[model samples]
Target chain A: MQRVSQRPTYKTIVSVAAAVAIVAVILALGAQKNFGPQQYGQLVVAGLGAGAIYALIALGFVMVYTVTGIINFAQGAFVMLGAMIAATIYGDASSGDAVGLVIAAIIAILATTLVGVAVERLTIFPARNADTLTLIIITVGVYIAIQGVGLVVWGTSAKAFPAFTTLDITDGTLRFWGIVLKTQTLWIWGTTALVLALLTLFLGRTLTGKALRACSVNKEAARLMGISPTRMSVFAFGLAAGMGALAGIVLAPATRPIYDMGLKLGLKGFVAAAMGGLVSSPAAVVGGLLLGLTENVAAGVTKSGLKDVFAFIVLIAVLLRKRGIFAAGTDLERP
Target chain B: MAADSYRSDTGTTTAPAGNGKESAPRRATMAGVVVLVALVLAIGLLEAFQPGGVDVSSLTGGVITFDTTVRIGILTIVVVGLNLLMGYAGQVSLGQAAFFGLGAYSSAIFTTRAELVGIGSGLEGRWWWPWLVMVLGMALTGALAYAVGRPILRLRGHYLAMATLGLGVMVTIMFRENLGLQLDTKDITGGSDGIPGIPRLRVGTFEIWPIERYYYLVWFLAIVGILLALNVVRSRSGRALRALHSSELAAETVGVDTARFKVRALVVSAMYASIAGSLFAHFRVAVSPTPFDFLASLELVVMAAVGGMASVWGAPFGVAAILAIRELVRTRLDLVIGGAGGEQEAVAFGVLLVLVMIFMPEGVVVRVKEVARRWSR
Candidate 1:
């Protein structure tokens, strides 16, 4: 038994060593390009900002998957809805209207949360007993439907969303040394940290959150214990949707919100969630940050057009490694 | 071989039935062949008699030209392969379009830039060049599917689905960005514009062109593809696939080699997409990345589902139904919604996919058959 256990530790060490070597090589390559610390700092900052949003979105993925055993494709659509609705409510907020923007953001998140609940109730809940493939396809359908509706309502034009700042929204950047940081980036990080703290506390302390966790651990056992799995499923969806909406609204100011922006962001978030084996929220947050940093730095070192490609490559690599190391036991194990 | 076992299993329960049980599948195959011949004859007659082709705009509320039929034929080949993989093998490939795009871009790049690719200008305009490229493309796509499927098919359900989706997006990006090649002089894949003016396919001196003649070639290959899929579904490997679909562990316990069978199914399906892609490139006389995007892959899945994934004969019907709906939306949606663009069609497809999966997971063909059987009784 000790020998069997020792194998994983050895494998983990080798994997960690390999990862370190690869990072060192990439850093050496970046140095050869003659880019100073300033450029590197900018890339790190930008990556972290993007990573924070991805972490928020990844939490939604982890939340839904643990409870429902579904990889919700429509999670991206919730993000899109939050951004689009918020933009619509606070039209042309790039000039600054702090109170108006806050009101719009609140309304958008609430509406999107309801949208998530409705999606689960109408589409997912009805077919709760169906196989995984059917459920996955259903979520995909929901995504397509939402995106279509978004197009019809908002048109194909990119909407303007203001950076959250007390000063003029247009001038929200802060410079320290040679590194420039957007105030919105700070907002994104702060918001993500607050949400994470709240989430940890809720799951750790609250009865409802514990019930939800119980359902995720084992649905039938939770049901036997008198916890309604169905209600918990609804709650999970709504909570995830709210998180997705928050991520989108915050992200919109950084990059102008388009109807189809969620597809890419949602996909990246899925990659992050997958990095956590689709089970651990904290791990997914770490995955998101790592993904963001790697892709940003890689793109900075190479061609920008290949930026999106790196996320998928990372996904494939992570999946392969996970399959190799966690082959015998994992959440992915089938009965 | 599996068909014989299936028949015998049923034969034992009804020994007195004799040859009656065996004739059912034979009859279905006969009906399929007859339908194909009839379709060909009807289209051939239409072309010979009405040179401009008949328009049934009033009936369908949309004009389905010969061009549309050609498209249906091309898509049928892909969807049939999809049916075998998804329906029989119970594997989902959200990146099937990548294989199709690979086949297309292979045909496009090789033929258009034969000299550029250092294959010399000699074979660039040869009649057999495109055909050779098509076969090579299928082989290449199959190899890729094997490499990808080995690792990917190991991840069941949602993990597999997401992995394939990521792959499809990655491949599409590669096509759009010219495989990340920064050539200052000449553009490979022509970048976003893609390769245009791809030469029409030919058999010696006879050119397959003007839409009418091309229809024959497309449908003929499509029929061949259908026949091939039907054969595979009835074979021992097909039974193994069905077993794997039900429960991989059980299949493995039976010594079915589930992993190998899954990978084989993926490879076969990919080859079918490659063939269809080649045909699409030749027929359209141009190749672009847009048609083989993630949405296109979803469209293929939708077709497989709508037509009854398990039924090989349902491929053409599924393609026709989807294309018909798309045409309907294109033509008539503006009147209903006012200035409806691509949005209405997307909504229609999305709703249709959800409704179909929820209400009739077995697909419309099987449901229709059940209804017909009931009504006949």
Candidate 2:
């Protein structure tokens, strides 16, 4: 009885500690002499834009993980591929307008979807019955292989493309009250909101999306209901790749896409997904936004290089505070 | 995945039943030991035959060069610990390399920044200081791993992996950013250039230098690492780890301290990485944050997987196999592919990882041996 009673007390202490830490960080950042309220507001807005990208990627992570029960480490690579492919295609074309940007993005998304399906069919499908640890390792392998291919194709330099609908130069900045924002900020917000709405409708109203949801609920029962788990896994990967590509292409204009950029971005996205219980799509978006804001604010106060550190601290803290939130099923009994 | 092989090996060999059954594990372990001795001898012979160093071009067609061999020795030591954690204990750690980097950086700092750490400047030039520093580095890293693993081991599967990944990235960032500590506007972690001039190991005025002597020293430690790992897999704690791996809840139901065992595996593996890191610093006489980043951690996982997770004997060969592929690509494949500018190594390693996971999830060693046995019969 005492042991049972102690568990809740421990939990209460942990939650309280996490809350205090979050508040302390915000207070520390606000208290900095070099930072003014205007600067803080601008940082928050920038953090929101960056957080939206993370949310997009985290959504992809949630989709694949829900359906396939595998965290695609290659999700980040898809993001990189999306952005780089668009940049490369846009650079190669003589045309220079919004039409070229749209065409490039569609091509990049379609191509990345193919790569995602190939990854599943070639590496993941064969080891579907393996343990979760084995599946994670396989994803890591696929990630490495894809990154290598990217390195071979794009070399080691950072690549850039013009912002969507901007044609050639980055010359659109919006000033609101004392805060400055970019037009790309609007693009990120618009894309995320639009995607989330479409995703909600698809999952709630579409037959295929419902089938995919059934697969996530119970693979065996879903199979008995005449839905193929394999096909759903394939579809999930394709959808995730599409989402990742959307995030990558959208984010590329702000931060130049490099061959190895996917690793850090993917990790940050994973952090967000974990914080949101890994299964809830909307929660992941909220977690991503919160993580971005906290990281940017911490950087504003302390040092820029430690921003990733701050984000990871939140990850570790959230992970310890919660248990069994993300595990869909135990894969140990299977071969 | 490797739990089956380990159980069969140790269980079948040590049972005292009166049934007339040959001890397969004993025989296999004996074979493993013999092979390891043969490997060391082969290295000796190769070095003897080519006093002026082995031809790099000749070995480019999938052969282990001498330099590659020593590097593999160091890596094998680290991967053995990983095999215990991932293979036996059934845990995922994406940050083993960070522990390794911490070990290396610790040794580098202790040897180079003795005064900075407030150990006084008098012990700077002493040869024996490095040996003590290596021990300290291992201890400190083990403690850090223990502290970090307690909160993280409670997580299952992918959550555990993410937690560890975050821990690793944090370590790398700290190293790259010099621990955010500055002295007179200078970076404490050497600011990416890294700390150099780490003194080599010496025992009572006998110095180990010339790179080849360091080879024997590293291989000696590698053999010890392998033997120690085998012992752990066959012992009582080893049984507990295997049980925990099979099912943590089941283990707990049976009164096994699952969390304690998991943390033990993590800390032990971390200690292994720490020692290997110390050796790495002393061997190269420098410490850098580059090799301790996420990719290096991933590479370590790749090595362990290639070796077949539960097989202690398979890890060294896994190290050799992966290193040989890198050397082969560096020396031969890049020229043929019109120069991918060093990107081909990742390509080869990545392809190897995918193919190995798809075809031989149990690893190259166990699968190849099974086929060979079938063929011989």
Candidate 3:
């Protein structure tokens, strides 16, 4: 029986290897046929920008999942809320008021943070002892409700959000050797870096952050030490939401803000977080960047429409690999 | 002997000693028969009322339209399968809608574009073609589920959820992009506009139509689906599934092939969704990617959750409750809120799902049953 079981594992490894080889060959051939060096460079840059936003959203996922052991599906909705609220507050895109944009961004982050806290308190906290499946479904419910609220508030039409600054560059874009970089891309990357740095300091240096880390490591132990798991869970959700909102506002100019954009963005963020085994924040950031890069490059090489398919493919592949590539023997929490 | 031991074990551990073990199946059968009769009576009465120019919508205040009833019946089939997988087997497939889409697209593509796929023109409009397509779709979907579930079901909780969700999104993308086939030349799946002019199901010379007949057909299949599910719940395999749901290690220790059972549950559920999808395609006279998207998958989950996940009978109730709520919101919300644009139903569903799972995770049906039992005592 043991030998029989071992054979399928061997078969799985062979099949996975073949699949990877085939994908690599296809990507290479497609790149060779379609993209010049500069085009490749352009795709990479665009991928990095997108990856930065995914990273921030993924950071929120990592925070919530580690502390609460719940994969908050509504994390993406925070991004949507942030973008929609900021766009609403910033008023008409033609105005291009930088100060208004800044204020809108701040207010959006704050409001989204509160929304996140409320979601945790009202939905998650009450059902803290529910099974993982129930809790997961509850988060899904929260996501659906939040998204519905978004639709009622913003309507179905996509809203335009002006770039933070053009950097005085022509057409709000920089070109070098046929590679175009939008000024908004720089903002996304910069904001992502700042958030990451701040998160590192906060998690590493502060007492509250240390307490949050303690709870994630062992909730019972932390509780024994007088740290309230409830308080940390709320804080984690609020902080995650704020980060998600920031990512959303930063990337809003590039990808038009819409009512339902959260689903895709949130799923991609999940893919990123999953790549990190849903526990490691730094690993999640790296995973986000890698996911962004691969998705763009693959989409650029193949059909652009298959871009969404690539993220999911990556997700399934990572999941199948399980303890092989991303994290070593995490053994995800069983229901 | 194994069955006896399992029965005694469950009796001792889960239920009251003797009568609870025996009466449960009997009660389930009685409930199933009652539901089946009620559905048949409702269909006949509705059909009878049709000739008298009786507005069926007036009877139910427009909440239970014939069209909505058909949809509810179709969704009930899907939710029955979902209940088996999630409630009994304790496995989650967030992408059940993908299987539903697969079934739908299979019927749509083969039926609408029979000649394009190299089928003989003679078979294109034949009465048996759609039936053959639906069965084949179920087979294909089951095979796909088996292949996918083997690796995916190994991941426990969040990983499983994410993987299934990804599978669903990927399938939706495929449907939207016409499965990567060129839209300009061989527009087979019809891309985003979806395939229209799908033929109605026919029984030799008689065609099922006028929405009322289709409701009968849908409910007929839904009842069969529910009965099959109920039987599964009472069978040895069902006991094994429930055991697995409670504890995989314990189930394995008791000699249940846990992995195979999980895969089987997934395959069965996928096949159920496929048949329902085929019915939906034929009924709607069109197959679109929109109805089978991620949100649709979530809606199916919501139905299962709302009706009571653990009970096969909860499937129809859940579907009806959700559809009724949606219809209520759609018709009345605009009047109440002023300029409500049909998006509030999602909000209502979302809130309902959260509230139900939080308060009564076993589902409303089970909760009501418990409450009733307590009151009777």
Clashing pairs in 3: none
lDDT of 3 by residue, A13-79 (tens): 9979997996687568676777667887888999998998898899999899889888899999999
TM-score for predicted model 1 compared with the true structure: 0.94
CAPRI grade, predicted model 1: acceptable
- Compose the digit string of candidate 2's lDDT tens values, residues A1-335: 12345455865798689779967777775686566778889989988988898889999998998898898898999999999999999885553578888989999999999988998898889988777777788888888888888898999898878866565546378898799998887899899889888998999899998999999999999999999999999999999999999999999888888998898889888888877777778878888888888888877777788899998998887777672233332231122
Ordered from best to worst DockQ, the candidate numbers read 3, 2, 1
Report lDDT (Cα) of residue A159, candidate 3: 83
Candidate 2 docking category? medium
The models' CA-based lDDT, in order, is: 0.84, 0.83, 0.85
- Stretch of 10 with least lDDT, candidate 2 chain B: B4-13
- The DockQ assigned to candidate 1 is 0.49
List model 3 lDDT by residue over B82-189, tens digit each. Answer: 989998888887999999999999999889887777787788778989999999999999999999998899988778888899999999999989786655777877
- The Cα RMSD across the true interface for model 1 is 5.1
* Clash number for candidate 3: 0
**DockQ of each candidate's interface versus the true one?**
0.49, 0.50, 0.53
lDDT of 2 at B208: 90
Q: Whole-model lDDT for model 2 versus the true structure?
A: 0.83
